[model samples]
Target: MHRFKGRVGLCAMVALGVVTACGGSPDPARPAGEKQQEQQAASRSGEASPGEDRAVTWANDYCGAVSELVRSVSEMPIIDASSPRRASETSGELLKVMVGGLDRTLDRLDNLGAPPVDGAERVRRDAVATYADIREHAQAALSELSAAEGPEASRDAVSSVRKPLDDLGGVDLLAGFDTVPALQEASRQAPACRTLTDADPDPRIDSPGS
Candidate 1:
């Protein structure tokens, strides 16, 4: 249980690893007329130009899926260690939530097609593979927790859960785009991705009202 607490603390930090997208700076030399023409063209096309629209769509969807995952994981219940049964029950429920969240995120990633940038397929494939591993570990932890019968067993099961959560905390979304400038720019334009920017770098949970 002690080890789990240490690892669980990383959950927030890991979720916060997503790169925050920043809006691009306006061109100082471009003529206002050209900007207006671009806007008009976009409006006439029903939205942005086809290429731009696809990039934004992909970015937004990606960010939204990630946000859902962070929220679900963040909702992990504070375990009451005083009672073995209660601890097991709460921990089990958290595993269920984690599994469900992972499952949904995996589906979304699978259907995202691919990012709209160079090396898009490789990035998408890597992300899917990594998340699949995380999900598998989570399922294994759930099974361990289910089979645990006593305090020592329960503690070990919880430790198993934390190992993956700790690894998750080390995930760095920006690292994945180290060579992809266009993908980084798309992330900056994506409004949903701002959650990463707003995330608390050192998050702490408060007990009930104290």
Candidate 2:
């Protein structure tokens, strides 16, 4: 009986050693990347145009708000819906309203675009683009979020993209573009603008309450 027990113990040790050997060293897991194929597939399905995003929705609202144009054209005011005079009149009035509305609606754009601030416009746009990019970074960050594998990275990447633009957006628009030197850099290339929240940027400082 003693001899039999000794043989069984020897076999058990050998089996344990073999199992450990086959297990290999435990290594950390790595994150996944956004597959290019997925991007292509989305494009095929009808993705938005390059540089187009929902971030700037105000422009559309501004256009819609200007339903009528009050131009000072000497043409006898024809009330025809399809007439050029009506179209021009509506267009001209709308253009005027847009100046003020744009300043209110797109304060961030106005700040970077109109401000004499250095790199304001470029910085502003790049910041906006960064928000769009962070959505992609989310897929990449999942793989690297674990500390054993690597420190959390994409949060910083996302913030890197959002901060500059958000900080600039915080710059009050009612103050006028003269405060920011980057005003020279502004162009009307942005799409219709909108905000996710109901936050209105215009401060009531200029109001004749005082």
Candidate 3:
């Protein structure tokens, strides 16, 4: 029910790993242990049924996959602005990495199917739809980036996916599973899986290579 406000740049940080980039601590708002406790209490109260445990587990697995995908691409060489050809090539490679990662992630999610929990059908449906949008839009953004002539153009091209990526980050797929402690903790660690406030600048996109 809580909506996060900010540019998709923040989501980029989540995908990219803010801690790795900024050498910063995790978001202060949701400490892991405390969040787990809260979620456990909620679960005990029957806010989320025991059957939903499987859904929570699946959600956590999905988040882990996303985290890995982001980390993998964030390590790629930054595009050099000084050389136009190199910039284009590097940008294309980065986009290719992103496309491949997203495709794999989406396919994995599809294969996993929805959790066999009561009242989880809707959450599963929405999560799948949102992920599909992310994949499609990311592919489109990759095309634009590949066609871009230079660094500035590539930056602009990459910016095109900001909205859809933001939407992907904003989705609350685990809304139904929130009462599950593990799911809550997992969501906290990976803000892209749900809504949350933005932290300081910790860009995923590295500076141009020297």
Candidate 4:
């Protein structure tokens, strides 16, 4: 199977690994769509001028979300291509993990409310939208994998899964946060961010959770 290309999201780090992967359901405490509603409510509440401490908190939260997403993606099992049916099923499982992880990450990012920075709303919206798009890609891949049958057809479908993940690899989820210098600096200090930095030394991008 094709591996994801260089330096996209943390997911790319393990995209090279094949096999089946799964788990990472969204938080059970918050029903689906509640995050969107809460985000909208928070948006209407107006922005606060966060001091240094608050800014650091925001960065830490973002970093924490990212770290979780990476861990989830890394759980995907190695694909067993020796059996077509098994390979197809495992590939589908991996896609499920991708979709679920992205969904959970998006919810976490939403829960972060607005980052404390100028143009915070726009930045948040763009970052969320980017991740949402990636999730959609993974969802589409899952659908394609589900419909596949036969050895040849299933192999083709399994191969298709790489594209969406590759697209994900090309994105920098954290790029939106860089618009605010203060927040960017604050991210450097976040212990969670440091953990991510250690995982993949490349500059972090926004992920579903980040």
Using lDDT as the yardstick, the better of models 1 and 2 is 1
Q: By TM-score, how accurate is candidate 3?
A: 0.47
lDDT of 4 by residue, 77-105 (tens): 56678888988888888778777778877
> What does candidate 3's lDDT look like per residue over 1-210, in tens digits?
332222232244322221121246646896789867866777686564434444444554565444444443444455555665665666666556656756665665566546554444455555567667766776787688767876678668756645544554454434444544554444544445542323322222221221
Q: Give Cα distance to truth, residue 177, candidate 1, Å.
A: 3.1
Model 3 residue 186 lDDT score: 41
TM-scores for every candidate against the unseen true structure: 0.68, 0.19, 0.47, 0.68
lDDT of 2 at 155: 35
- Output the lDDT of residue 93, model 1: 79
Report the C-alpha lDDT of model 1 over 105-138, residue by residue, as the tens digit.
7787788855677766676678778778878987
Ranking 2 against 4 by lDDT, winner? 4
lDDT tens digits, residue span 1-210, model 2: 001111111011111111121246533362233445645666687553322222122222221121111011111122223643444343333223323333333343433324123444454454344323332332233223221222234233322322322332333322332333322112122221112111332311111001
In model 1, the clashing pairs are 21-188
| Per-model root-mean-square deviation over C-alphas | 10.2, 31.8, 14.0, 15.7
Prediction 1 global C-alpha lDDT = 0.61
lDDT of 1 at 61: 68
Which residue runs does candidate 2 get wrong by more than 4 Å? 1-34, 49-51, 54-210
2 or 3, greater by lDDT = 3
lDDT, ranked from best to worst: 4, 1, 3, 2
Runs in model 3 deviating more than 4 A are: 1-53, 145-210
Q: Model 1 reaches what TM-score against the true structure?
A: 0.68
Clash count, candidate 4 = 15
Runs with alpha carbons beyond 4 Å of true place in candidate 1: 1-49, 173-175, 199-210
